[model samples]
Target: MNAQAKPSLLAKFGDRYAVDPNKMFETLKATAFKQRDGSAPSNEQMMALLVVADQYRLNPFTREIYAFPDKQNGIVPVVGVDGWSRIINGHPEFDGMEFRYSDALVTPPGASAPSHEWVECVMYRKDRGRPIVVREYLDEVYRAPFKEGMKGPWQTHTKRFLRHKAMIQCARLAFGFVGIFDEDEAGRIAEQSERDMGAAQVVREQAKALPACPEEQIEKYAAVVESGQRPAEQIISMLQTRYELTPGQRSALLEVATTQGDQA
Candidate 1:
């Protein structure tokens, strides 16, 4: 493999790789992704897998990484636990890795239970002064209500998956290979993952659906506070009463109000 030349997908992994799109499509053809009904994973998905594999030096055949068609649009490339290991361990300056897990949750039978402790993965790189660390609980990894049919990681292997989640995060940080989004973070992003998003006290459902209040709205809210008129409370009352804003809408309005008032 020439340093200047792009490596071929059909060809084995080497230095300076770029996806051979045609070869990747061909590779996908032989997989379960190829429908017995003669359907196939979309071109977009195949290309996504190809680009990801090329950049990460992953081989789909070996299951270094693969697309899970069960999810929405089926474009999400799920890196195997091996994929995280490969990328983190394969780096030139790689040092080593470590992991830790908390005790299991003590919920009653068939009750909603969180993991005992958040799992942590730390990756050391020779060049960087400190290790890259990522911590996540079972809840952080899976946001959707655990379906009846699907095996929940919390039930099947919560600690294992959480460890894998942390490793994936550390690998992404170490390698800066972000061509694919972590499937864990795909459904929703969480700064604090413990809360029940479905609960009204946590947040209004409609408010969650609404996009962030626009920049202009925030600025306008700030200006109003600066004027010392139509206090935040009064404004919120109006939005709530007049517009009959859903919990989501009221939350958005309140957030903007608070943000602006804070500055004032």
Candidate 2:
């Protein structure tokens, strides 16, 4: 007899949105994302993407939401402009929105085109007492061309990008949308996080290469713990950077610190 195929996590919805989760995943695997290495998104990645899509009621088949690999071996859910528009306007309490543009234009440090000084978005919610307003400055939000000198939408459609930034910020404040990011913002954050994690790993490897703590130094630390001059955790962390500590040494230090702390 043949084994049964397990249903996808999205199967719980049972076509409520008229989407077959497993079929959609199979289709998206071939089309949604074009990786740098020409690889398709993994099943796990597709599942994660679907979860976020379901949460926000976005249609991945229409490219409303997509996935990007994150530093911590997870996915960053990136929403399209249309997706943002749908979510904001679809909110039950969303009353209306208005935009304000700056009179002056200025070119940012790295931008290829000049943009308005700022754009502001004011979003009103029927349930709220006051409207939520957010201002985005072109100079601050402008994205420069890639290192290869290729210009992105920010450089080509400066005003639109500025307006989008303002609207997204305003919506976040008004609606409390969390864990979703714009494409550019998601890329930058993921890359920066990966770099930070890589640096942290290097530091950890260097710390692990350090010599074991000397018996005399360990005794000195135990004495300090007994005296309650410094926190046990703090001293242990400091010592860890310079030397490897055994479990027994850590336990002994904790015991001494506990004894001293109890007496006080």
Among all candidates shown, the one with the greatest lDDT: 2
Model 2: CA > 4 A from native: 1-9, 12-21, 33-36, 205-264
Error of 1 at 158 (Å): 1.2
The residue pairs found clashing in candidate 2 are none
| lDDT, candidate 2, 53-133, per-residue tens | 878898776778877777776678899999999999999999999999999999765556678999999999999898998
- Deviating ranges (above 4 Å) for candidate 1: 1-24, 32-38, 69-74, 103-115, 142-145, 148-150, 181-264
**What TM-score should be assigned to candidate 1?**
0.55
Question: RMSDs, each prediction?
Answer: 10.8, 6.2
How high is the CA lDDT of each candidate model? Answer: 0.61, 0.83
Estimate the TM-score for candidate 2. Answer: 0.71
Error at 201, model 1, angstroms: 26
Candidate 1 lDDT, 1-264, residue by residue in tens: 657874454454322235464554665656723543466777666666777787788767677776654322355566666776777678898899898776766332233455545778888888999988888765555443356555554455555656777877777787686755454553333322324433554456554554544446545654675466767667656444334444664565567667766887
Instruction: Report the lDDT of model 2 for residue 188.
Output: 90
